[model samples]
Target: MTTRARNVISAAIVAGLLLPAAPALAQSDEQQRIRKLEAEVSALQRRVFPGGDGRYFEPEIGGTSQGTTVTAGTPSTTALTDILARLDAMEASLQTLTGQVEVNANTLQGLTTRMAALEQSGAAPTLASAPTPTPTPAASSPSQASTTTANNLTAMTGGASSQPARPAPAASGPSSQRLAAVQAIAKPKTDDAGDDEYSYGFRLWDAGYYPEAQQQLTLFVEQYPDHWRATYGRNLLGRAYLDDGKAREAAPWFLNNYQADRNAARSPDSLLYLAESMIALRDTDRACIALAEFGETYPAVAAGRLQSQYEANRAKVTCTN
Candidate 1:
């Protein structure tokens, strides 16, 4: 009886232990399979999204109270790249427009300055007044009595036939007195109507009354075309236009001054102003040529401020050797 009982008891204990081990082994196997499936899913996600380890999830169609449907999506690389390219293009366009606007503004400013200058110079004369010609006096015959007396006297003196003395020939050129008078009128110390017109105009120019100065200078040139100071007047007139930002208009005047009288008092100055006007107009090639011509024409004039101005302008234009 004791052997049978011991065998049965041992069998029951072994059966219980075996039953618990089977369930535990099955659970472990199921967990390992689940882990393997998770690893595969992670690898698939990496392949699909490449940028991150997070899985992509579609928006759930939650219960809708209304008929409208809502949807959302992540921005794709291609769409984002297109948007960036558009933004870059817009920036470039904006930069180009800004540059053009700046150029236009500069041009407008120059034009305004030129207009102001033109207004200041007074209206140009339509026609210069010509000098009035002097009338020659008619020759008068000697009185009859004087002639008879001369004849009688000649007869008494037993002289040959007397002939009326020819009037002395008029003197040639201006007299010393006339020249002195001109000088006095041209450079008077007081501010009188008889003062030198050229000096008065030059003073006005120096004082920045460009319009009035130009008018006075023009009148002087018109009234005294043969005067030596006419050349200076022309030069100053051109300078007035140039200083007022009317370079294009100034250029023609300067050219005319140099062309009309190459040996005039301010011919070299006219050429220099011409070069400056060309530079202002952005004609660097012409400006350089003009400067070179000035050097050739007035090489001796290279000592004063003129030479320094030439060098500075040349550098500004980036002139070639």
Candidate 2:
């Protein structure tokens, strides 16, 4: 009935009405935020999985999709193990293939070298017996002996007529002396027999006894396979054979020396001799190849100590380059 009581009652009634409607406004705002979030998630799914079949969350336990069930069992663990095993197997196979590739590359390189040799050998000359060494004067004709006697008589007269010239010494005298000198060389008996034997062989070869030189050098090489002088022995053996008119047999030895160790001291010598042997065998094509290889491989040696020999062999054959 009073104004103050009436105002208090009106304020209570207004508070009660606003308090009931506040919860409904809050609920409406919450629903709008959830819808906005759902729209944003849908847009993200479209960008991430254009196929439109992707799940935003993992499948529920024991749920089935594509006929395979998600479960608490060990199926996933087994699949992971299988994938790791496959990866390891693939790695091992890759290593094996890599090793095989290396082997193939080496084989290919060897084949290429052989092919090049074959190509160069296409027009090679046929092998022939090496020419024999020239005979000494003991086998001279009667006319030659008469000429020699006249030359001796003229030397004794000193350009004036003289009393009858004395008969010349027997031809056997010089031959016997040479034989005795060669026989006196004797095999080496010292501790450094390899060096001694090589020296012996060299002397024999220089003295024109190629068979004896070949024998000594062969023994030297066989007995001292690892000796430093082995390269020299091998090369000398080839030369002895070549000098003996056995070019067919000599060529392989020279080639072996060059191929065995290209860095050996006697390697260049062997190559030059190999070319010589090939030329002696009438295989001028291979001879040229060997000479070319010598120039390319040992330019310094080809231009130095072996220059004369190299040029002489090159002149025997016609090379393209």
Q: How close is each model in CA RMSD to the real structure?
A: 25.8, 22.1
lDDT for model 1, please: 0.59
Please report, as a residue range, the 10-residue window in candidate 2 with the lowest summed lDDT.
121-130
Q: Which candidate's lDDT is highest?
A: 2
Candidate 1 lDDT over residue span 1-321, tens digit each: 699999999999999889989977997786667667655655664566565522242323222344223233344565467668989999999999999999999999997776545323422212222323332222122421234432332232123222211112345755787546434433335432322676677666665656555667667766776665566667777787777676765666666566555566566777777778878888876676667666766676644436666677677776684
Q: List the residue pairs that clash in candidate 2.
A: none
User: What TM-score against the true fold does each predicted structure earn?
Assistant: 0.39, 0.44
Give candidate 2's total backbone clashes. Answer: 0
- At residue 224, give the lDDT of candidate 2: 82
Over the full model, what C-alpha lDDT does candidate 2 score relative to the true structure? 0.65
Tens digits of per-residue lDDT, candidate 2, 1-321, equal 999999999999999999989988997786667667655655664565354442332222332333333333234455467668989999999999999999999999997777545323211111122323332222124422344432432232124332112123345544777779889776555556667777678777767877677777787777886776777778878878878897866766676666566676677787788788778878766776677767877788778667877888898888887
Residue 239 local lDDT, model 2: 79
